[model samples]
Target: MGGTDCGAYRAGLGVYAIGRLAGAEAAELFAHLRGCPPCRAELAELRRVAELLAHCVPAREGAGRGPRTGASRTGLSGACAYGSRGPGRSR
Candidate 1:
C-alpha cells in the first residue's frame, strides 16, 4: 500500500486500539493491518500506550475523600510518572 493510504489508517490507530473504531472504517483498517507490517507495529505500540494509560489515573480514595496526594499535587511529575516502584525503591 502507498504511504498516503497508510497515513489515513495510521491517524486512526489510537482510536482503533481503544475499541472506538467501528463499521466500514474499522474493517478497512483491519484489512490493511494484515498486509502492512509497519502499521501493525504502530498499532501494537498504541495498544500498549492505551493499556498503560488505563492505570495513570489513581483510584479514588473513597467517594468524598478525593484523589490521592501525589497524584493530584504532583500531576504525573513524581511517583505517577515513574509508574510502580520496586520494593524499597523511592520515587
Candidate 2:
C-alpha cells in the first residue's frame, strides 16, 4: 500500500479495521505500517484514542439500590410478563 492507500486505511476509510485481521493480510498490514511513518503516527493516534475510550467511566455513581427485586428480578414480570394482560390492560 502506498501513502494514499495507507491514509485511506488508517483513517478508518475502509472496512479493513472493522473486521478481524489474519494471516498474510495481517502480515501485509503490519509490514506497511512498519515502513510508513505517517501510518505509524496515525496508528499511534488511534491507539491513544482507544486508550482514552477504554479508561472512560460513566459520570453517574451506583444504581442506588440494594439489589433489583420484583419484576426487575425475573425480567418476566415487567410490562411484557409471560402470560399477563395485553397492551393497555392493567395487572
Candidate 3:
C-alpha cells in the first residue's frame, strides 16, 4: 500500500498499530518497518503516543478538596503540548 512514501506509511501507522490493517497489508508494512529507520522510529513514537493517550482519564474532584487521585496530565508533552509550558500549565 504505497508504504515507500513516508507520508503514506505514516497515514497507515495507527491502523496497523491497532490491528485493523488487512492481513496482506499488515504483513507488507511489517516487512517495510524492519529495514526502514524512519518507519521504525515513527512506529516507536506512535506507540509512545498511544500509551500516553490511554492514560487520559477524567479527574474526579470532591467538594472543597483536591482531585481524588494523582492521575494527571503533568509532564505529558507531544504535538498537543499537553504539559510543556510551565508548572501546572500547558500550551
Candidate 4:
C-alpha cells in the first residue's frame, strides 16, 4: 500500500471527502492520507474551499455583475479578513 501510485490515490480524495468512496476504498485512501502530509493538506484545503463555494451566491444576470471591486464580504476596505496589523497598515 505504501508504494501505491499517488495520482490514483489523489484522484480519490474528492470522492472520499464527500463520503462517497466505497468502504474498503475509503479505508485505503485514509491510510494513504495518514502518511502523506502534502496530500492531507490538499484534501483539507479542498474541503474548506468546498465549504466556501457552498455559501457563494449565484452571479446576477447582467454584463457588469461581479464581486464589488475590492471589498470582501467582511466589509473591511483593504483590511485582511482577520484584522489590521498596526505598522503594516501603513504599507
Candidate 5:
C-alpha cells in the first residue's frame, strides 16, 4: 500500500483538480504534482471516476420491490429495500 505521504499528496492533487484549493495552496499542489509522478497519476484516475459518477442515472422511487416492512414503507427504519442504509440520521 502507498504510505501516508503519498495518500496526502494524492488527496491534495484530487482537491486541486476539482478547484477546491486557494491561490498559494493551489500553486503548491501543482508544484508538488510536477515532482510527484504517482500523485499525478492517482489524481487523473480520481478525476475520471468523478466524471463517471457525475453522469450516472439516479434510481427511481418505488423502483425497488422488496418485502415492505414498517421501517421500509415509511423509510423510518433507515434501511432501503435495496439493503442500503436509508437517508436521514445515521445509525
Candidate 6:
C-alpha cells in the first residue's frame, strides 16, 4: 500500500519471499526492490512470515521410515493451526 506503483510488486512479495517467484518476474521485483524502500521493508516482513510458516509445518509421519497411515495431512501445524495472526497480532 505504499503507492499505486508498488501494488503489483507487493502482491508478489509473498511468493518471492517463499522462493517461488522466478524468471523475469523475480528479476523485475529485485530491481524494483533496489529503488523501493517500502517494497524492501514489506519483503523483509514477508520473509519473516515465511520462516515462521516453515517451522509451523508438522513433520510427516513415517517419512522414509515406513508406510504412512490413513491420517490426513493438513500441512498446517503449530503457529498456523489456529489461522493466520496477521500483522501485529499475537497469540
Q: Least lDDT summed over 10 consecutive residues: which range in candidate 4? A: 81-90
TM-score of each: 0.59, 0.44, 0.51, 0.53, 0.50, 0.60
- Give model 3 RMSD, 1 decimal: 11.0
**Candidate 2 worst ten-residue window by lDDT:** 11-20
Please list all clashing residue pairs in model 2, or write none if there are none. Answer: none
| Clashing pairs counted in every model | 0, 0, 0, 0, 1, 0
Q: Sort by lDDT, best first.
A: 1, 6, 4, 3, 5, 2
- Tens-place lDDT per residue, model 4, 1-91, is 3666789788888877666789888998898988888788888987887778658856557844555645554565645543477434555
Best-fitting candidate, scored by TM-score: 6
Put down candidate 6 lDDT per residue, 1-91, tens digits, no spaces: 3344897788899999999999999999998998888889989999999899779977786655753332224554545644478535766
RMSD each, Å: 10.1, 11.2, 11.0, 10.8, 9.2, 9.6
Instruction: Please provide, for model 3 over 13-58, each residue's C-alpha lDDT reduced to its tens digit, 9 standing for 90 to 100.
Output: 8877656788887887888887789888888888788777658745
Worst 10 residues of 3 by lDDT: 68-77
Off by over 4 Å in 2: 1-4, 11-20, 57-91
Query: In candidate 6, residue 86 scores what lDDT?
Result: 51
Candidate lDDT values, in order:
0.81, 0.58, 0.68, 0.74, 0.67, 0.79
Show pairs that collide, candidate 4.
Answer: none
